[model samples]
Target: MQQLSKSHIPFFVVLVLCFTPWLQSPSALVLGLILSQLGWVPTNVPIAKWTKKLLSYSIIGLGFGISLSEAFKATSSGIGLIVTTIFVTLILGTWIAIKIGLDKKTGYLISSGTAICGGSAIAAVSPAINANANQTGLALAVVFILNSVALFVFPVIGHALNLDQHTFGVWAAIAIHDTSSVVGAAGAYGEEALRTATTLKLARALWIIPVALGSAWYFGKGKQKLQIPTFIFLYIAAVVVSDLLPQFETLYHMTFSVAKQTLVACLFLIGSAISLEQVKEAGLKPLLFGVGLWLAISIGTLVWLLY
Candidate 1:
């Protein structure tokens, strides 16, 4: 029998890391990076091939985790703030990207990520806007890296300001770029904050459908007509099945738990794929554009939460 390849160790590490949220995903990313440098995994691995499929499946499974009633309540109460923030961030973020010399597609992709749910928003909007792989990768990289930062930083900011749990939850949900970061930051602050932020973030995620369509229309992809992602429908199905079968709450919870774990693995695979070329391709322009939108939502939501 052949001895086990030592290279499998980091791969195993990545496998373990993938089940976590942005809070832990960042660590996976950093470790993946270091392991890649050490030759534990080749930098040329085709991570995107499997990652896209797993990402969609994990998202669909995420529905099993969100109660429809809870999501609806969050939507009803936070819809105004969610809608306004998304719209403003998209328009302003796109404009900034253009002014800073990024392409229109990259600009729109980053804006969608920043305005909505980071990597998910960019993934959802990419097909509609006809974004190429490099464009989507750049957008995802920026949002993913910042999401890692936000996971740790937002909680510190919330505590420093002496904000209450409810206020911090809403602020995090409205401000942070990704659900995991929003949830992670708030979870650090308080349990109630976690519940509130998760509900609001899930509710905010529903905007992906409309935003995807809108990008298609505004960018001329509407000529091919709209095509919704099946994961979106599957996600809805997961929510319905979870709610209607309350007796299976135990099972649904289990399903969601597995899904979160899959997301952790997914992040690991994605993190391993980043390279110096991609970094050069991303450049400072998109980073600055993303930072602008990130700062905008962070400060803007805090102000709204306060008054």
Candidate 2:
């Protein structure tokens, strides 16, 4: 059996700190990134898989804190904007990618990610499009870099614009790449923003199914079976159960609190998965494509929200 070495110590230390009250989402992400950059992350652990599972569980747990009625309200109110932005981002992003001479598969993956739920969308679409490792990794790398930036930059922009909780929450859910970053940025903004963003983001995530299948058809791989994000159903169930069991309000609240901290840890795991090599592998055109597409969606959505 492989044993833990001195190099693994820093990773564990920072990981434990992620659960502490003082370390917030952005700090946890930065710490994890630092650990990876320093080569302190243990190679044995499946950090990416673990991050995905933990994030799913944390999202479901967060559902317990939300009222089913509010979830419905938030989702219903934002359905039009969510649908519109997803299609626009995908179309505009694809056009920009082709114009910039990026690889088709890589461009599509990045565009799907920006259009939907970031890494999740890319992961789902990659297999359908039969993207090779290099292509998939590059797409993920570009999205991750942008996701990290959004985590920090969105809140600052939100405050600078004096956006209210609802406006900022909507903007973050639409503009941010991944659900983790969306939750992190919105949570930092305020509790109302957190609730709004989480619900809207997950609602947006449902589009992954249709988008993935469409990608398979578009890529002439219609035989490929799509992996549905079943956790979304679990998340909805969590909200339902929480709403039905008000007698267990204390327990639900406790789970919600723990889940938020767990999400912080998930961000750390996600950050640890990123490396400089991945960034370098992403290359200039794809990175520029991602940044440009991200900027367009960010600004476009913010403008629509404001006006």
Candidate 2 C-alpha error for residue 286, in Å: 5.1
RMSD of each: 4.2, 5.4
Instruction: Estimate candidate 2's alpha-carbon lDDT, on a 0 to 1 scale.
Output: 0.80
The candidate maximizing lDDT is 2
lDDT of each: 0.77, 0.80
**CA lDDT for candidate 1:** 0.77
- What's the C-alpha lDDT at position 127 in model 2? 56
Residues 185-224, candidate 1: write the lDDT tens digits: 9899999999888889988887776787678778885366
Predicted candidate 2 versus true structure: per-residue lDDT over 1-307, tens digit per residue = 4567998998998888887788866577667777888988898888766776776677668778767665456669888998899999888877877887888888998999899888767655665566654566567768889999999999999999999998999999999998889999999999999988999987876676567667767777444654445665676688789888899999999998888788778767766877778656556988888898899999999889888
* Alpha-carbon deviation at 50 in model 1, angstroms: 1.5
